[model samples]
Target chain A: MSAFNTNNFSTNGYELPASVGASLKPEHFASILHTPPPLGFFEIHAENYLVAGGPFHHYLTQIRQNYPLSIHGVGLSLGGQNPPNLQHLTALKSLIDRYQPAVFSEHLAWSNHGNHFLNDLLPLAYNQQSLNRICAHIEQVQQFLGRQILLENPSTYVEFTQSTFTEAEFISALVERTGCGLLLDLNNLYVSCRNHNWEIQPYIRALPLAAVREIHLAGFHREIDPMGEALFIDSHDAQVDDAVWALYKSIIQQLGPIPTLIEWDNNLPPFSDLLAEVQLAQTILDAYNTLPAKAQP
Target chain B: MTFDAAWAHSLLNPDAELPADLRVWNHSDPAIRFAVYRNNVVASLIQALADSFPVINALVGDEFFNAMTAIYVRQHPPRSPVLAYYGADFADFLQDFPPAASVPYLADIGRLEYAVIQAFHAADMPSLTTQQVQGLLINTEKLAQLQLSLHPSLQTLQSSFAIGSLWFAHQGAGNIADVQPEIPEALWILRFQLAVEVLPMSAGDCQFLQALLKGQPLGAAAESVIEAEFDLIRCLNVLLQKELITHFHYL
Candidate 1:
């Protein structure tokens, strides 16, 4: 593990704000550090900050002072055939030890296979054996972090024929066995639903909603394959599509104010543009929170 | 082979047959669906290598870099998932890559970019001020045994070729055509956010840092400098001024 001053953990120097968050980006470092926007917290991809020193840690230390942090991992490869890489886990543990983010999460996909590591989040077949491995990996991650981490459902273009369980069923079972939380990336849900022709409502209902600790809202790329099928790739480059926004509305209406993260990793706009998206989420969350308890569905 | 291994293999080697039991929609072609993933896996990594070594990409142009990267990534997929520190072996790969061989110094540029990016991610430590440097030298005996701690983001590259000039030319500091190789150059890289600056150093100073980086004490490190014009006090001040030396601890 890299050396870090242990538990230098402190609050974002404010009473927690709203339940809407934005995935932190390097482009907004100066602006966010100078004047933090009103959001519950910021989520970071754990792999981005795995360096030993320099401006990343320097600015993060300062910005983290005002916003609660959520460290998300894309490299954990939780569903890989081999055990999750210990070095990746160690780097994650060090970041967690230093910052103590409010929510720590990683995708359910596996990127590393054999000796080679792929940068993309590749899908895995959902079978009992795969389930056993993923559960074990999630347990290992939580043990290292000493905190509950939410496992995110990945955006996949294809499905495996031999898999017995649905994605929702698989994630729900992992949550049950490991006591891990769920980060329902609504955009991923939308993309996978379209690609596989699965309905969003039933999948969302089948998921262990109570265990959900956060929601990810990102945009996707839509293209027609050679077979003339619409393939919704979770590209996270464009604006949140209308279909995704509708799904997000339905989800928040049901879930009610879970920490919603607006993730824009590629083709990033100015900080103000991201803020505009965050504000939209904040508005929906505010409206939901204001609804009478009995009226909320 | 396990199903996961088959799927993973199919990505890099398109000829690797997919496991027969693999699932996809019956109507959609499995090959193309799988190809989407293969494209994503390859493209994002190429993008990552591009991000890490942009100057190299600028020098080679996107068309050449992309072609070189496509082959390089297939042969040498990253061993770890920390994408920021990915492409550690690209420099070595370039040294052997036939297409990149025409620009032999391109690999050195790759190496320099890797060092710069790695240093950028290094942990932050407060560099010592001039007063702190003076305070450590209470006496020659004490100074002789002092092992100076270099700043976390400070990295030096000593190349037999003109790495600094080529790099400076790429960053708009000098004309690429004006660069002419003379002596072996030591390039210094330091980071502050998106900004990274590379400074050319005398061979003697590079030797001095190389020794200090290996945890050598001051008196012995100074003696290791091979250049005849090496000045101990002046080299120490250059390091101090550049915020390279974090602290000096006596052994």
Candidate 2:
């Protein structure tokens, strides 16, 4: 396996064939790999291909030759007090070396402590301490992988009273310190906003749009607590909610056509069904991309 | 305790108090908020265990399986972020677990399933080609020095019960209730073209393979099996046909 050279790809240089893609599913590997979907890219969870040899790596290697790849991780624990785990970091670095994904990204949350990894993207209190800890962690990760990564805004069901910075401010600070980019998750913005009765518009407005490189659109599930208070869950098990789609369209219109991913992790539908959703994102991206050069801001 | 420690403790133990440092934007009691995180953590780990040990889950119905996994996960949550490597100690844990005392074979079943899962992710190396293992001779000197190499994905599982039967029985094998506990069973678990195959072996074949696994040459292994009147040619044919022997050399 050869290392992916990040220098070869730039937003202004060689870009991904299509702006819209779906996270690669094992069920769709045969279809996508054999036919090689035109203008389609794939995103994968880095942990799934950590092993030395398996069907997962075989297919990913084959599919990678044609389409662009994005490596999304779930285990960085960037906001934890302890420094990032060296073993995990080494494995992630090996992956980056093996497959130079067009882009690499992880959550803006912590999922590890001491030696054990909790295996869930636990929420963090957005304060000065966490902001500093995460920036250092992201910098360490970037230095180790030899490339800057995009930190995504996480969806949470709760907030800390001790939080001194809003989620957007915290992300902005990390970007400023590390010179990293952002993978704006529109579904998360809507889910977190509705869960705490916060305004989505202001949160989106506060973000540094120029630093935004990719966008995530996914489905959500609704739940009502025992006390009859409504709560929305960011379960990527269904079609993208109409509300999240609306938010996504607005972000693209404001930020221009950034590469967007359609994440369907659970209750995965057929290949055609997932592609249909990808096409929907393609439609939105196409609408923004068609504006004349003189029609710029 | 620090915020992360307190937060992890609360999530691990549903009965634990909400961390004083933990708070929600809207309300004071954050118990419901805690529940959402707790649910995600517990449910996802249980799903991991079930996915790794589907045979165990099927042998014991979902209700009992879910109950067992729920207890097992809380007592021993994942220590690594890689969900693929989770539940390695489940078989050992089930042996001492009180609720599982009724089924002594349960531990062995779990052991078999864990191997199957591990074999799927084990390192890949090409098996020996046909030209490698040419012939089996009756001469003592020639056979004494030959050592067979197994593939990285090849593993042998020995259990006191018919775990292979129980495993297949769960996979639409009929009349499991009528089956009875029998002698020890040995299974050749390996990955064949992206699929895990569980091949049951007779006692003589298993002992011969076991001797081979211990780095013994063909003469010693053959002598042991020959004492039991095991057919050497037949065993070699099965092993050769399956491509289990990656390569062989004179010791």
Model 2 segments beyond 4 Å from truth?
A1-18, A225-229, B135-141, B173-178, B221-235
Cα displacement (angstroms), candidate 1, residue A250, comes to 1.6
Q: What is the interface RMSD of each candidate, in Å?
A: 1.9, 1.8
Tens digit per residue, CA lDDT, model 1, A1-297: 211122122333422244888888888888887787877788888888887766777788888888788888888889888888888788888887888788778889988877678888888788898999888888777767676777898899888876899999998888888888788898999889888888788998889998787888988987876678778788888778888788777778887778888999999988888888888888888888889989887
Q: Report lDDT (Cα) of residue A122, candidate 1.
A: 83
lDDT of model 1, residue B208: 81
Question: What is residue B95's positional error in candidate 1, in angstroms?
Answer: 1.3
Docking class of 1: medium
Worst 10 residues of 1 chain A by lDDT: A1-10
lDDT of 2 by residue, A184-238 (tens): 9998889888887788889988887877888899999998654566578888999
